[model samples]
Target: MTKKDHEESGLSKSVWSDADLEEMGWHDATVHALFLQPGEMASRLLLDLDYPVRWVPPVRRRDPFTFWVAPATLVFEEVWDLEGSLDFKGLAPELELDGIHRLAPPDGRAEYPLWHLEGHAFELKFRASGFRQYFRQAPRHVAGPMLEYADRGGCAFTEVGFD
Candidate 1:
């Protein structure tokens, strides 16, 4: 679905907008994995927040603000082009995201937007027709190690006796 459609549907409501991301602070967020699909159909970038944010219920406000780390997956659909320099080898190799930016479509690509994902040691540039962010699971009070544990059918916290 388009960004507007996702917004109106409520089911896939965005957890954070550009301004919200900036305000909440996504700098230094850990990127555990980057998945590129065949045929450039889509790409998924998994991230673990460096600084957990306070959780605010949608229906009501609560006292004693609860902080949580919600791992997120950014899906870029209809990827037209993707270029990156990254290595996923070594012990729990991960990238520290400097920032993620949504830029206007490049020339001759009016229908797609360019996404720039910058990290401490790598950079990814892509053009996709659609994009969405999905939280992997319920928020946890503590941020686990920077790794794609959920995708591998494991819970980082559980392994560390934090669950």
Candidate 2:
């Protein structure tokens, strides 16, 4: 991928460029191949905090990784939307280094006072700047103040889209 073609991978064009990312010899497909489930890839990053990944499975395929060793990246137009500049940028990395998992299935729910995390199957969403944990799936019981803070900060969580 080239900086001029940043749109091809649906990465944060503002934060990453094709040319810069190419220096690392990695593509969305390359990371996707490393993980099987949808949140699996992002969870690795969130857990390790070594990279920022946005994995979107192709529209035709319901599964993010069709094979155990699928190395090809899927092409799609949708992307995750994140807003506002980060204040505590170190939060993500710190959390990951502490051995924390920030993804949850719909059957499970976790909360951290002001924030919550929830996911369904392959889908996941986190709504906090630097949470010690993940989001809770309980939609109705979410913290109103935390959500309001997220809203004021241009949506605290990154909105992911699948093709």
Candidate 3:
């Protein structure tokens, strides 16, 4: 949430140590990125990269509308962990902008909950400086690395350190 908090909690702390990640069956540089386009457009990005990712239900809300219409946002948090890496820990929930589904596709007049899968694996972590900044302001969207996700899913992850 707050950079100051992350700095203070030692969650974002950097501790340099000698550790071989590659030798332990762990890879970090390979990034599998998924960008869900806006709802105005019709499309879906499905790739057989590495881990099959599940679609987490998006958070939504309703606002006062005088036009007898509603607007909603389809949000998704996909996660992956780097095994045998000593630098990072915990499941990292990467935010994804799933298409906003309306009562009518391509139309924003109708209100509806966004649809997403609960099972899938991602090949890479999403990092957009703008998003980080936005979440920093909101504080509620605070998310760490994919290691947390792996741990939560009962999957094994590793962390390596380089000194």
Using lDDT, give the best candidate's number: 1
lDDT of 2 by residue, 1-163 (tens): 1222224333322222222422322122111111122342232212201222333344566644221111112111111221222233444211111111333434343321111211111222333223211111111112111223232232122222211
* Tens-place lDDT digits, model 3, residues 1-163: 1223232222231211112111211111112233453333233222211121111223543532111100111122221111111123354643322221112323342222222222223222321111100111101111221222232223211121111
Count the clashes in each prediction: 0, 7, 30
Stretch of 10 with least lDDT, candidate 2: 112-121
Q: Model 3 off-target regions past 4 Å?
A: 1-4, 7-33, 41-148, 152-163
List the candidates ranked by TM-score, beginning with the highest.
1, 2, 3
Against the true structure, what is every candidate's RMSD? 9.2, 19.6, 21.3
Best by TM-score: 1
Runs with alpha carbons beyond 4 Å of true place in candidate 2: 1-5, 13-48, 65-163
When summed lDDT is taken over every stretch of 10 residues in candidate 1, the lowest stretch is: 154-163
TM-score of each: 0.56, 0.17, 0.17
Give the Å error, residue 24, model 3. 29
